[model samples]
Target: MTTLKEPVLTKRIPTHPWGDPTDRKVVSYKQYVKTDGYKGLKNALAMEPSDVVDLVKAAEVRGRGGAGFPAGMKWSFLPPEDGGRRYLAINSDESEPGTFKDRLLIDFDPHIIIEGIAICMHACRLDTAYFYIRGEYHHQREVFEAAIKEAYENKIFGKGSKLGQINGRDPDLFLHRGAGAYVCGEETALLESLEGKRGWPRIKPPFPAVAGAFGRPTIINNVETLAICTPILERGEDGPKWFQSMGTQRPEGAPPHVPASFGPKLFGVSGHVNRPGVYEEELGITLKDLIEGLCQGMLNGKKYKSAIPGGISTGVLGPDEYDVRLDFDITKYDTLGLGTAGVIVMDEDTCMVGVARNIAHFFGHESCGQCTPCREGTNWMSKMLSRIEAGDGTTRDLDLLLEIAGSMGALPSGRGATICGLADGANWAVRTIVNKFWDEFEAKVSKQRFVSLSVVGS
Candidate 1:
């Protein structure tokens, strides 16, 4: 028999989520800061914002959210000078179905995230920071609140910290708890919630970069984004040097937009997998490796069928695509998107249609109902998916689903009744069912009808 250790994602993983052996756990926020938490800030405060931004750019710290937007450029969007109470809001609302990675960061090492947020504040010349954690993550909420209070009491944050002199003044930090709305996971809506208003998506002209969190420039980041900042600061020049050493390298002219090196993506792999735990690995780690190696293979000897990469919003991929490298180049896949980096597996017993319906129903229920298309389209999609899954659908129902998904996914501007991700999520469910399990759907519906008639005759 042979034994092997699971692979490491990137150098930053252990320092961020796994906790540093040399450092203390986030027992208290005061403990975290007293234990040298704000190193990122200390490092950045000595450097110019542009210099700090350049280091982040060199390190390739992209958005942890599905979009993978370049973090340095986003920070550069902040106006120079005081910018009047500019804010750094951490998007700790980790409600995306199948995504549970952020919960660990919040609960396990709150200081790393706090330190990261402070570094971001330095980069943007802003002092105020907000950790907009999810309401239902009560454990994390409690943990983070304690850490924030401790940080405040110890003077690691606000009023007297090193950040106070960014423009010759100190700024405060705000820790807000969001009432569990999935839409609040969106940055602008999260800001709205923080402002004591209904969580609704705001238009981007005034992108959050321009006007946000009570009309001040804002930069919202995911938990992992902030957590990684601690290590990035600790390693200094060696930090980026270490990052370039992992995953597949991008040769010049291969793709103009793709970054040259792969980085870490923390994934929470659940459902049907044998291990069923969160694992951090390189960006381009194959799904097969994720399932067999990290997840310890499938459960109950069941054969794998499909997966929802990232989260529920990410489109479904059949078993064949499992070997495809999981990276940002997912633009080619029909039903896949670079979502929350959550891997949810399903075996053959898993009805793709049922799975689609379950995900669609969640999005429909979570829709804020502010937009007509998203509010109504998600409901219709969920209802139709439910009918199909219950074996009450016709062959024409498949066409109806396709039409509905098309309108929701790429609705004509202002003409069709669809807008934002709620509609897109609904559309993803409908599209995945139609494309991936057309045969299963057709068989189930016809079998149900035949069984119904036979029962009637008997």
Candidate 2:
């Protein structure tokens, strides 16, 4: 597929292959305007709210938060204009490991995100907004808070705002800092946290769109997901077609229900890469080109062994899977999804068992303790992986790890599993690692640091 002609999202932020990151600095409201900020919101305001939603739907802007849900389709899900207190919660909870893509925008170009928030509020008629930021982002919270302050002063929000009262309420935004709980990164949990309750995923049927945030309609969007709306809105009517022009078309016979991975995406490269950082590129860029070209190849010239295509949750991309395209359709290769597009690259010497152990530990620790399978299964897998890593595990332990990883987070139809679907990151992360690196896992189980598998797919 053809690559992006120029950075759309990072145009002002100064990402690599285009501009120097060293020259980056926090953009003020004035600088943001000079750089063409808020224009999208202005355009959005001029159109009917439904028309604005239609434009985004036409563009098919998928969620950057991880789930690849189309933003406009999500907007359309709201149960009509009840003229009550609808809400918009901007998710800046960048808790996913290796995923610093959202942080990059919030750090430097806060207005772009702020403007996107405004446009979304106007489009969806969401009157009140909450920027549910990561509690650990102390500095980013300050920066974003200051930006919101500037927006208020400049009449971007508050009563008599440029967009006027939305849904019979003044358009307003607030920053709600999270308590650093990874579970809070889940949208419902974020809502619960925003509402001064424990951060735990709520069961569906009462999805946030219908009854979110204090029993009212709500829209939760990621910072990057909203940030991308700026460029699309700026381009006006050509936005959708412009967006569709860049990314790869969905593979033939693809599920009609599945959304297309059109438009550019921000890929955060971490781990053993020479130039590790966030780089905005077309959705279909190959993992090999991303590493060898933009990342400047593996660290210390060591050969690349594997990579987690989009955060640990999406699972590992084997050395042979380097040419795999980074897109929503990547699940065809057996990943959960193109999760947050945070790639964690691994070098040849890296221990697969150790990687799996660490991932299992993280997910096990982060489970909200609400789902029995997620709570227990992750811990069991973690303990098993640890035992195997400690060279005290037998072949039975290895088989058990696979079985637990496979069965974990499964619904009631398959016993011993319960998760919010959004909470199944660990299930995929640990399972994919052991499956792809079976030889390594089997070897480690044999008290060998690196041994070939004694049996295939055992």
Candidate 3:
């Protein structure tokens, strides 16, 4: 339960601008307003909706959700407002393993997210926005509910409120509690769940921008993505420029001025780190710098063995890969994936085979069972890994595990077999562990066989 220390970067941009990180008390609306909290909303309300989108796009703010999709570009995809109702769904289902930044934001700086929602509602011309929060996060839900009530009381969302009204209509915000399903973190599944249906992902081609949430056009964004709107609008063009200035420059052979990643990123660092908590740092900070410099090296002075640079879904990076820049562009590195910036570090004594098995078990149990490749594949991989970890697996089991995982199309190039990213996470967990630690897995099997023979002879 170690608290995350302040970020180590000297030239860091402002994060948690409204609330003091050390103060556990939630920042009140009065305090929030004191720090220019609703300025972004005011600015966004003044401009044409398209201009708001262009401003955010120029800032290069990518989705904080693991996908790294550009926020402005995503908003731009919404169909014209032909007098039809549009909705903005905030994906507050912070259920990803090793990821907790969204919950932190809700707990500490709820008003910021509320303001961001208001700004997005203005920019998108949506009268209603839904906060689909995880059920397990009851505390955060209460915080958000209180914040929304405060906003309403202060005329932030009802009639006659400058921030809440667009074209004389009062905008509305609702909070929906999820049933603690991990798959609901997926946008379409979340939308389905929000519509009071089973949380199964729908096929594409009628993307959410076209048909979403009761057949109305929708713009679904992660909590962090929406929260960033405040700063983006506050700074105007400078906002995007400031965000772009921090991350690594776009690599060669890419569109001009395309940042590799942009803006300050909140990283949830856990598992064997000295401070197992969320640390905000600029994007493109090297894993080595985060581990050795910010995290103060591995806990108890242990040597770093491996780490999941992003969330567990991103796959593991071996000790040698520590130098890889922690940005969306990490995909350029072979066998690496950039998920939600949840970093789970492992020390030298940790067992890769066991780690893979546990992760596989999580996905297996969490799979919605709608898709066979994922439903069956995740469970099968879990069982194989468990047997191997329990010293009861054969060499062929290892090969079969890889074969099944590969066939699931969990790898980056191997998508399209499942309805969502859950299976890909399961696949990457097993694939990367076996790929990087084949020797360990093989030795586990060999040792188990040796022990069986010895016991039989004895």
The candidate maximizing lDDT is: 2
Candidate 2, residues 1-458: lDDT per residue as tens digits? 22689888888888888999999999999999998888898888888989999999998889999889999999999998877999999998999999999988988999999999999999998999999999899999999999999999999999779989998878999998888898888888889899999998888768899999999999999999999998889888888999999888878887877778889899999999999999999998999999999999999999999999887777888878989989988987878889899999999999999999999999888888998767887888888788888987777777777676777664332243664753367777887888899998778666644434553334
Best by TM-score: 2
Q: Enumerate residue pairs that collide in model 1.
A: 9-281, 310-342, 315-335
State the lDDT of candidate 1 residue by residue for 1-458, as single tens digits.
11112323223324323444245344455454565656667887778777877888888777887667878778888776653577788898888889988876776677777778777877777767888888898888888888777667766676787666555657666778888899898888888999999998776668888899899888898988767766677667776666655545664467666765356667788899887766777777778888888677889889899987888877788767878667766645665466878888999799777887888789789989888767776777788778878878666666666776766642342234543455676676567767777888787566544333322112
Expressed as tens digits, the lDDT of each residue in 212-278 for candidate 3 is 9999899999998888778778766577776666666777798875556877778888999786766
Candidate 2 regions exceeding 4 Å error are 410-416, 447-458
Judged by whole-model lDDT over C-alpha atoms, candidate 2 comes out at: 0.87
- Model 1's lDDT to the true fold? 0.72
> Number of clashes in model 2?
0
Count of clashes in candidate 3: 1
Better of 1 and 3 by lDDT: 3
Measured against the true structure, the TM-scores of the candidates, in listed sequence, are: 0.88, 0.95, 0.92
